[model samples]
Target: MSDITVTTEDGKTSVCSPYDTTFVSKAKTIGGRWNGPAKAWQFDARDENRVRDLLREVYGTDGSPTDDSDLVTVRVRLADHEVSYRDGADAKFAGRRIATRPGRDSDVRLAANVVLIAGKLPSTGGSMRYPQINAGDDVIVEVRDIPRATLSLEREGSYEIVGETRGEVDVDALLTEREQLLARLAEIDALLPEPEGTETTTQEAAKALGVSVRTVQRWAATGKVEARKNDQGRWIITITI
Candidate 1:
């Protein structure tokens, strides 16, 4: 028998455990908020993995709470595809099952009851990665932890699941990558030895210089105006007057 109990209420994972300094410390470190009313530590359901790990550490095994009471059921509207979750699929990432059974209906609603994890992984560049869905209608996705999850809709094409699986963002990795990029950028900027001038976008420069955007582009291309592309490959012009 496990000394800890894990349950879900109001979209939050509630963990009731015996008073252990180690468990309390680790739980607080993992952002578990104390709930006075329930006498349990409440956490974002997406952090279920971390909570389970803690349980495994303090207790010899993951908490014995296997009741559906611990599961959080959320409704997701899928367009052009139906999603079905297999029992015990949430045990491991590789074991996750998102079976899509498409039908004649334009939209299908599925209740993701046993889903503890959701959302796309972060990109290599440390920016957010938005999973593309079918663009017929706004598809509401279930992001387990946070209140909001960003997803994009591709126009005119059906969305393919491919080998993609939902996972939480590695915030530490993203922050470290961002810092390294910024430092490298600073070094590159220093090496360029270019004088900092009034930096503005092509559109803004065009409006300021009272010229057409095409004229601005022409000027930039011919070196008639000092302009360069930013990280996003957008034209940034150093304009006078």
Candidate 2:
């Protein structure tokens, strides 16, 4: 490794490894020269225990430390590619399964779960070494940019390895399922009887129309639609549908 020195306008100096200093200076001085901020240092290791120790040092806890109970689970499917790492496990790139930590900056630490391929790799192994990925012999585990929300784990101050698995649902398939559900709900709504009176309170109209109470109120207020007042003095709106 080479060495380099950087000096500030005030003549403050800092020394770093050639690679490290070049990267840092490019980030600090060149601004957009490298596209975005400098890449974070990844803690890569084959030993699970060692990986956990490194995480504790960096994240300030052995497990997720946060007051919020909302957790996130991510399943990243890498393009068939390989990458080289300090350990043999990262030689042949393969897919990885990861559960998110509770606090912010969780996405930056996914390198802790990198896994390499063995002598006899999967059928998809050939694609893992593509130049676009440059993953080497391991499968590249691509992180999904969109984060997910998950139910809180029962254990406190610790995260459980939920096990990784192959075969994932496609985004299009999920959207199709949602559309079908909405259609079915619309059919069910059509089967219900209409509200008794022409004018009904937003709440009553929502129940009778099988829609959200807010939806009914919005129509009444914005559409300049009229509603009926009940004996209890509650304003009820009749849904056009």
- Which structure among the candidates has the greatest TM-score? 1
Error of 1 at 65 (Å): 5.7
Per model, state how many residue pairs clash: 0, 23
How displaced is residue 233 in candidate 2, in Å? 23
Candidate 1's error at 16, in angstroms? 0.8
Q: What is the C-alpha RMSD of each candidate to the true structure, in Å?
A: 20.8, 20.0
Q: Scored by Cα lDDT, where does model 1 land?
A: 0.50
For the record, the alpha-carbon RMSD of candidate 1 to the native fold, in angstroms, is 20.8
Clashing pairs in 1: none
- lDDT for each of the candidates? 0.50, 0.34
Q: What residue runs in model 2 are displaced by over 4 Å at the alpha carbon?
A: 1-151, 160-170, 198-241
Candidate 1, residues 20-118, lDDT tens digits: the string is: 456778899989988899899999976776897876665434444222113222324333332213211111111111222222222222223223133
What is the per-residue lDDT of model 2 for residues 58-142, given as tens digits with 9 covering 90 to 100? 2222222121122233333332322332211222111222221122222212344343222222322222222122222333343
What would the TM-scores of all predictions be?
0.27, 0.22
User: How far in Å is the alpha carbon of 81 misplaced in model 1?
Assistant: 56
